[model samples]
Target: MLNRIETYYDAVPRSSARAEEFGPLTLFVQEGQGWPYYARPALGHEGDVPVAAVEKVRARQRELGVPEAFEWVAETTPGLRAAVEATGLTVHEHPLMVLEGEPLPVPEPEGFTVRLVGADDAALDTAVAAPFAAFDAPVAPGTSARVADRITAGLTRLAAALDATGSAHAAGQHQPVGTVTEVVGVGTVPAARRQGLGLAVTAALVADARAHGTELVFLTASDADVARLYGRLGFRTIATALIAEA
Candidate 1:
């Protein structure tokens, strides 16, 4: 399962956008997207990458003008965390989770419905904007256009939760949530959270993935509470994710 998840993550940037190789690392770069974080360093199961290899990864990120960041499964790449940290980068650890068995039936919460909007510009705008508002962060310029590129590339399926009046209250995407189908970008507006909209949208995506023959679904939660929330829907922690950022 971890191997599959790792493969999925490695394939995402390669499949949808531009992927460049630097020795043992793969760099995903999507320029002009305003979402600098989208440009990532993907290190797979290459065990104990040499310090020079790590420097090359950082050099490539600098050349691409993207943030210096990479995510890897520590167990898969032994000593990688120490190597990255020695170079003045910070490593953050989190659970790498996967959905197990059958997902519980997630009925649409009352007064809300899940909508599959695909890549429609207007609908995408609402879907993209809701998270920024919910998190109280400025909507980075050009993010919508970058996301649209991914959607139009047939790389993402966008979903959202709407109120009775049809206003988008929360949104998310079901993409190769790493190398397998997984739900991501699940977020609810402050006004709409705690009412089960997040679960509703996620469940909708899970059902859609299963219907399309995707058997194993996976995602990385922001924290334990989010993990626990998905746990109720059948996701289980399978490994730990180590992320290094400069």
Candidate 2:
């Protein structure tokens, strides 16, 4: 399962980013409209990685004006954490979770409807802005070329909880590659949180993935508490997901 998950990790970014090799690391660089990417242990690589190699990847990220970030599974790349820490970066640990069986049924909480967000939906921009608001990111910029285009093409799937006004209160997405899909960016706006909106949106994504033949679904939670929330949706922690950012 871990190998399959790792392979999916290596495959998803390749569809939308350029992979730059740095010894044992592969930095995924996205030059266009997609979200920023990061470095990870080169696919199939094993054993210790020299600190100097990590330094070079960081230097290249700096040169490209991208985030100096690296992500990997702790059990698969045990030596990377120490090298990342040696560079004075902050490393965070997240629970690497996988769906064990059918997800627990999550009925739409009162006052919100959860469904897949269509590319040309009238409230598309509002849907895009929802997660940004939930994460307290800068006000979401105007939507021009949206990830929803990819959703429409079947490359990705976005689910959101919308109020009566058709504006999103919570949103999340999953990207399917073959039989695997990774659930990411699940969040609910502060004012709308604690209403079960996050779980509803996530459940929508999971159901959609399963209905479409996606065989593996997984995510990395922000913390133990967040992991427990996902557990309610039937996800189980399988490993530690690590991220180091400068």
TM for every model, in the order presented, reads 0.88, 0.96
Pairs that collide in candidate 1 are: 8-178, 8-179, 9-178, 9-179
lDDT by candidate, in order shown: 0.75, 0.89
50-138 per-residue lDDT for model 1 (tens digits): 67778887887888777888788766776677778888898888877888887987778888778776666456787878777877888
RMSD of each: 2.6, 1.3
Q: Which stretches of candidate 1 lie over 4 Å from their true place?
A: 31-34, 37-45, 141-153, 177-179
Model 2 misplaced stretches (Cα beyond 4 Å): 139-144
lDDT tens string, model 2, 1-246?
999999999999987799999989999998576578999999999998889999999999999999999999999999999999998889999999999899998777998889988888876777677888888886534342557667777777888899999988898889999999999988888998899999999999999999999999999999999999999999999999999997
Candidate with top TM-score is 2
